[model samples]
Target chain A: MTVTATAGQPAWTHSLFRSGWLDGSALNFFLEELNPAWSLVRPAVRIRQIIEETHDTRSFVFKPAWGFGRAIAGQHVGIGVDINGRRHERRYSISSAPARGLVTITVKREPNGKVSNHLHDRIKVGDRVFVSPPQGDFVLPSPAPQKLLLIAAGSGITPLMAQLRSLLSGRYSGSIVLLNYVRSQQDRIFGAALDELAERHPQLSVHWCLEKENAERFSASQLQQRVPDYAERFALLCGPAGFMQVVRQHWHEQTLDERLRFEYFGTPQPFKPDDKPAGVAAHIALARSGRSIVAEANQSALAALEAAGETPSYGCRMGICQSCRCRKVSGPVRNLLTGAVSHEPNEEIQLCISAAEDDLVLDY
Target chain B: MKKPHPSRALSPQEQDALAAELDALRDSVVADLGERDARYIRRIVRISRYSAVFGRIALMFGFVPLLWPLAVLALGVSKILENMEIGHNVMHGQYDWMNDPRLNSQTYEWDNVGTSDNWRKTHNFKHHTYTNILGLDDDLGYDITRITGAQRWNPGYLLQPAYNVVFALLFQWGVALQDMKLGRYVLGRRPLTEMFAKLRPIVRKSGFQLFKDYLFFPLLAGPNLLAVPIGNLIANGMRNVWTYSIIHCGHFPAGVRIYTRAECKNESRGHWYARQMNGSANIEGSRLLYILSGHLSHQIEHHLFPDIPAHRYPEMAPKVREICERYGQHYATGPFIRQFGSVIGKFFLYAVPNLQRRPRTA
Candidate 1:
């Protein structure tokens, strides 16, 4: 997000800040006490309402603070909250329409999720939260497709729900099919809203795949029976990794990958040391400091660096804060949180949650 | 010179037990850190920042007689709060767990002329790691004053009492210059080019401070230029002297110990804790005074757990004293005047020669 010097201030005030005679951060520091929502640069939002969508899920509606920019529906926004005395940030897809002045995010509490559980238990209406500008590539395609197939499972319905709300509220003339999967009736989110919309709009079709009711699992035959034009329509899929993996493989086998877009939900399970062979070590080289350290397969990069007498800045030790995020110049590293092996060069990784997969080079 | 009195020694087993107990205390406190700690620091930041803004705005109306002194006092309090309570503690990574970018140790820049980077190196790492170790800790005498009797007496030290006044008046500049190690440059050890390279960031940082207080803000006060700049100067001087006394009282009080490098080598965790307890003294005062001093009044607790939040020092202080009592370790503490008086006494007592010696070893 651009922090243009006090946007509505006099031209001279902008120049004053630009000239370094006045500091924007210092001004923001003073103003934050008066109103947590007020900031010179950073975007902040105040919780205005909360909606219980399910037994385990709730939707938070936020009013943007002054200087907070607009967020498009279907895009993800990073919401930061202080749990205990520490701040933790997590990204969630905006579940509200861009036309709405208030932004909403639907969150499902995960058993082991620090941020999700904190938001569900501790956050209240009128509390302030820091927000990142709207992000992610999961947004709806421009010049809306004539025939759209939307698939979601569990909490993955958030972004697709937003796309559906935005599209249905507007003058877009299109045939939309929404397939929502849940475990039981109580597990379904936005059930009433989706039903109301489907009844009001003739072009919209709502399909509920309740697993507890022994409904047929998603398959080629079932998809074909539900939507005869599914192969010809653009599809957006979001679900648990397992569900998406199956659907993705099916689409790839059919060479229909280009017609489908997908996003993953649910936490990636943490790495277990027992999975690795004992006595294996990864060599990590610091590019700037020219120091090399050896880390065991179970050791986080932060721990290894500290053991080598390097004082890298870190917070929470867990991957909650991005404070320890630094550039990985080369080689592979496994995210301890998800056990996902990342081979991308020159990408930023959190030192606290990353274990060297092999010989690695880092920009310290 | 008179050396510090040696205390009762502990067995290696006793030292290990001491380490475990202190470690337990630290862990318990850390586990309990939550909204209360975050709120305390945020309140301090709010008070410091608001005071600064209000003080500067008040200085703009410096033409009013009563507002001038009040503005200067406000600015002085603001500077003390920022430098001591907020800046010093945060730069020690005390509030880093909060994960607020503003409170981060690595990037926090205070209102002082000293750059945070320099302070982190010289103060946090060097001074803290070698609290009272001679030659190794730059803060032993700040490379200027003969703070402890461990140092050899010199004719130069005769003027230390006189220079100590000037040093207090310009403590921030003294701290900013500490990392430069200018003594080497003076003695023709460090090359002028190398010194200049190290001097660049300091000059840039202090230059901004100078311009802001003396020129920029004064210019903004169109009619009452003299009062604004003058008020700013006195405000800065107040902070310098106040911090100097607080720091000096903590480190250089009469009963504080000074260790030789040989004696401190390869020390264990508990041994290090013992050394810190011996080397630091605490000032007793009301809660407000502790806040104003940035909780440095509990210097013993701070030395033990530098990264722990300072406001937690009070609650931890009584427990720490109890531990010290059980262990038979001297936990030095007294009222502010008594502590400051002892520090002042050390200034004169350490300046002259005293033929006395004490044998010690690690």
Candidate 2:
């Protein structure tokens, strides 16, 4: 049998061939035919319709021109737009019903966001966009959420809105709290529709939080205050980067099992903040001399340095991508993962994930 | 800096001692975490910082490293070019707590390890826990292989490396038979609900992701379309072969026992651990070896302390061995090259249930 038949093999894939295994032989047939190479799924979607969501937000309904589906909701697609000829991709949550033939994705223009801004301005009703099908583990289980809190800030509500619409249209008999956060009254998405849904359901409540006009910052405390007592209320929060950060800074900190859900608005770079190398404070203190040296755990070392006020040089942050890699002169740094430490006795470190463990001096 | 080996073993007493030690060694490992590690990191930071500053200068100077090479049809090692090590490590949950040291973030959950409900219970649990337990370890002819009485091989698969796409390109016909034949034989009578509920989602997405990873990127490797796929084909083929050799080398070796459930239960925990050691092969626990196999060389450490991060195994190994030695249990281990030979011997010893292999037709 060929690899095609056994295609869905587990992806613990690595060196399956040797230096000369595929050389000058019919086994080359198996090499190319059986082993997984690349190019399976991509976005390749055609926009079918558009719905005005808010002042800055809009829902773009798209259908795969080819075969797709077999994917779930909360799953995201990497939509590539050919703008100025450089193909740029932005991963967006599939805000549409999985049962529906076409998947819906709602995009809110980022004020200074590159792709988001380009998409909002240039993408049209009949545009064909390249996209990867639902690439995240963010979908809700079927049977609908029993008591759900669909949280959103800015346009982060797109996916949750999709979930909400799917659950409601499917005759879901559950209570849902839609915590909609916006800068002002002009920014709320699906506002009137939510209001009407809330009026009819009685169990569904729409908590609108517009920060500029709502006086108090619609914060975790306020969120906590709203859902004060519940043995089982699932929170699906989304929004602007800062807004989601704030929500995460506030939501269920003491637990990780079964209560919270996250649909981050950032690229999937393993959205982790805990992998900062040891002695971050010490380096911050050292780098702080005459320069603002705050450790941006979200960034590479060079990125953090630049953000901190140092002009630094770098390349690809991926190890093999060796663009932003540098020579380690001295000092110990802990690997963000596996928490292993490597000392100065080496060539260079990948600063993208490396953090200093002491008050130190860097080459640049 | 490097991945810890996956086959590190701990004596019974050391296993108990490790649990206690980890609880107490919190933050204390930093003291012994030497200057070499520190300097290596700082240098990387420095080089990275300088490279960024200077690369922009170079780009301004009209120095396009990759682009210029792409011009000459012989780009040196574009396979290494596309390999996303960061993505690999991040997927393994390595980067989650790299910053805060508090493990405050949740990493992308893979098939095995951790108690997170999200992990797809692929043959991972079966392959690792049961090793070569035939009729139980569905890993042999799982969702990947094409056995007898299975999906007929499609010639179009020669275009791409992964089997799924070859199958898809031919027709979505053969996958069911392949899955049925192996999945039927290896996936024993666990609760049907357990399979559907726990494993289905992971199996579903992973299958598609496999196609995407194998076919999607290669088909679009670069400006030259064929260059993209051909390059991917080479890289992916190499990666798969290495993975296959390392994997089968561990369990199929001679002297390893493939026990039934009754045999497994009757053995004491120590003996059971010994069974795992006996069943699996140990590669060298070198830094480089750990990396190539996702540190699975410390398979014993992996089995003993699945929850403890893989990096901690090297540090804990010597201590673990001391305890195992004291217990007088067979803590199986050997260099990787030696283990590889053993596995080849075992491969013949425990032949795959071949009645299911596809029939040869003229």
Candidate 3:
């Protein structure tokens, strides 16, 4: 048997070379050369539409420059934008379902948050912003639970809304109870949409805990009265620290820890401050650069290094990622995540969360 | 007070303040790392690959006589882009934050015959750390051509003009040989055994490059093998000349300073910054030329921040120039042709050093 050129190789090889490697080489290069922001590695997404969700929160819909892979509901992606001349990145949950070709991220303007305020005030429909591929562990399982209870407060509704949208779209047999805690009727995010979905689907139920209107908080007793079968459901709790604390205590008291799930929206606050002197300026010697600068006790080594114009790699400034690991040559450094102080001579420390306790040397 | 070196116009205290400010500027840029730098490199890599592929395809069809030179030029430009913008910057750990194994500084190998390991040791550490310091920086004259008045004149330098041309033609091989310290081996400074051990990687890398360019790609053309290899040879030569010119223009410009070993000893950060500014020169060009030069057009900024991404150098140049002005130091920068002309002029000037003058100290 003789093999011709087409017959010699497998069909998959031709398709692979035609689409995967050789496929968009010229077009991708052209797009990248025109504007680097549109490169496939960090695709620029143009805001297609904007929805005002509440007083301070807004949902921005974006059309990615390249073909974006569908993200699992509840997953977050880091959005990057150049505010002034500097780039800032902040992770936000994808509030839109995969079936919706456009991606959506709901933003709640924090009082002093740089990226949040920038996105809310400066970003507009038709403007482009760079986005990373969706990432995060807080996602619904492939075979989702039959009895799902989603408890959210304020902007925490973003991810849960995604889950609700996804569940509603699918042939889900589960009953979902959304116990949303808001300041008042005006503060409820996706209120009209949630109401419409609840009216259409018998399995979906919506409950609002308006703190200002009721002048009462959602205590364990109140939650029990609202949803008696909450203990039987797989509960996903997402809210501020105080709200999470109350929910966590209730779960712990009932020994329902396994049924509870949660996601933190921001860097977890360091536990009660240790007796280490606060706001003391300590000398930081950069070994490679052969320079020394003072790092305040209250500020992270990364922050100090950055303020001094040193570029150290970092991602997720919450001490979870090891991108900012540097050799602590000497002196005391405190781990912000764990209130442990190390006076070791040479050890690697994460610059993002490690604060200087005294004079120190770092291999930068 | 008597003046030391003309470039050392600032007092120690002023130098220290300038260094602190520059360091702070670098930190601020680093702290703001985001999509821009990442996208810049990714796009460059894609364009480089596209250029290479396009050039190879055109070369393979070398039966058409007109396509030969164009293919060679394209391939040469592609190689230059890869070596300078992508390979050099990535190997300097500029994009080390990306954590991609292929783009990593520690492991990335350029398309050139010179191995990445040797370049890191010789260029990244030795050349960057020592800069233009005499007896330490081999790059001062590349250990062969005497481009500065600091080096002692020898009868061998009479043939330097001719040797400079030969070095330019085979620049990649010259760099590989320089990394091996071939002159040290010839003079018996290092033993033949150790020299050969170091030359192993260079030889292996050269062989791989030869096989790919001369044999493999040509053989793929079957009957058109001869034309393809010849085209590749011309392309390689083009790349050699381009790199040789750009590199020499950066360090061998007329007004650029050369330091003595004693002056650089126990050098403070501020002093080191001063040395880098004095020693390096920049090429004035358009964005296209800057990209082609791998932003080494801003050589002064590069020398100051060897590990920072080179794409940032253009933005940093003005700030650095301001700092130099503040310190009353010369910031050498000019058009490429003028810079290259100065390098060529200096190449001849130092051929036979006049005994009337002594080497100046910092």
Candidate 4:
């Protein structure tokens, strides 16, 4: 049946009617109230199961309520929760492949981490948690490379596991090697899964470098010994800052940086000095709020504003995301990321990364 | 210059101490902020949208006659709730920490014809800052009514009763025009270019609203187009009247005091708190009534904790009232009908110069 637009009726009229107008709109509203996962902003998911990987680390499997688009292997999603009346968000890599019909996020509880500790201690099966649709560019490249090397340490095995699972499932015709580093055998995540996959697939090789047990560190020689043609492989790395730094140096020295991909879970901690620049306090004037706050040389504008009980909109809390960008109406600011001092008036700066170097006015 | 009534005066040290105490109250509330507030607003938003859409659809069947009144009533309630409970508090930055762009105070635009940007400047900053001080708060008489005796009496006020009725009928339009400062334009205090720039959004919003009600939905009804437009008119009129009554009761009740610039000179935080309490009145009602009023029923609490989510006001009101009592201040509150009646009475009373003696201080 050919359907044509009726006279005096716009093209959208039929679609609007088919969409059920008020009933359709009401259905969406009702579903959203029932669970935010039905909405576009931040769809929610329920924790289906929790698997303990280590004393401090666990994997949470989730079943999203609705409209959770597929995430490519090695991507991450932002997880948010309300704890004691405050909403906190943190991004975690998906550990499960898209074909799994569920998503899993492996988390290692940090002593001072708010969202991580909350997920570890408070979250339980059947509890709903809000999550942004999967995002991040850390996914495996299109047209898979002929050779691949996956290196991970601590809780960083998550995204690599996803890639490994997907590659194995896709029957990837490539030489694949996984070098997993942990404190001990007990600390290794997905140990049995890796062993099973290696045993089943002749092209897949698995190596565990137990730092405490074997007293071994990741080096180019060690990597070469296991995967002789390591130089010809596309490498993926994830781990603690120290481990990642060492691996980065190794890749740089070998001129393999072009073939290497990595992702950081959080912003790198700035090196601290015994004493901050003495008497270098800069006054940050919030123009809209008509208030001035003192920002020490060690503090970012965001930290200073937060300390002064001012809430400025922010997300990611990292320079990579521009959510915290604000107009710097006046004065000097030092970009913590670029290590460049800017005195340009009326320039926009990310509050999360810019430190007040001189008296600054911000359109907060 | 007039001073604060001697009975209400406090030493500088006392004022600072009281201000610190009030600050502590605000700090405590801020610290206690959480998901419940977010959930409360989200629920209201969902309900408002559902009802509004349902009302519009019901009006499509306006030819049925019986459904028209129900549709208009539903639409009116939905619009009122959206403007008051959701839009007002959200735009106050109460839920800004949620980081949802739709609910951000700096970004949220209400369903009303009043532009959110203008409302933020006029209502959020100016009115909240000035409360009921005569010259500073243009809301004292909406620059038109003669509800406060402090406002200069003129022959123009003799027509106040007629104007008051007209104002009530078109309260939303008046609010839209309020920020435009039409009086300033007429008096040549504001430039024509600036006035038009300010009027641009107002005109655009009003045009869209008119099209949605008088044109789009009505035309969608086809043979019932006339009935749908009439239904829209009734709905808008109902919303205006209801909003006007609630708003007037909040500030114009008999016991609610209006302040002068001289009385509030160099006002400390504690003094500001006192003025807010004196300037605003609350309507006592059931939970349903409170919800219907968009929690404006707790206007005194709203004035004090303007940035806190309005849903939390009822729980906070008693504590705020206790603090006021401890400071020997009056927290005006009464039933809705009594408050509305008192406001109407005050409107008539202030129409002419007071035959009664003026306060000695003034």
Scored by TM-score, the top model is 1
Candidate 3, B139-176: lDDT as tens digits: 88898989867678898998999899999999999888
Query: How close to the true structure is residue A344 of candidate 4, measured as C-alpha lDDT?
Result: 41
Top candidate (lDDT):
1
Q: For every candidate, what is the interface RMSD in angstroms?
A: 8.0, 18.4, 11.8, 11.8
- Tell me the TM-score of chain B in each candidate: 0.97, 0.52, 0.95, 0.94
Quote the lDDT for B238 in model 4.
Answer: 85
Candidate 3 residue pairs in backbone clash: A308-B24, A309-B24, A309-B26, A309-B27, A309-B28, A310-B27
Ten residues in sequence with the least summed lDDT for candidate 1 chain A: A1-10
lDDT of 3 at A244: 86
Q: What DockQ does every candidate get?
A: 0.31, 0.01, 0.16, 0.25
lDDT of 2 by residue, B212-292 (tens): 434554344433444444433443454444555555455544334444455454444444455554455445757856645
Alpha carbon lDDT of each predicted model: 0.80, 0.48, 0.78, 0.76
Span of ten consecutive residues with least summed lDDT in model 2 chain A: A1-10
Docking band of candidate 3: incorrect
Docking class of 1: acceptable
Ranking the candidates on TM-score from highest down gives 1, 4, 3, 2
Worst 10 residues of 4 chain A by lDDT: A1-10
Q: Local error of candidate 3 at B211, Å?
A: 6.7
Which is the better candidate, 1 or 3, if ranked by DockQ? Answer: 1
Cand. 2 TM to true fold: 0.36
Error (Å) of candidate 1 at residue A44 is: 4.2
Best by DockQ: 1
Candidate 2 positional error at A73, Å: 2.7
lDDT tens digits, residue span B86-165, model 4: 87777776776555545666546666677776777778767887889888887888998888666778988878877899
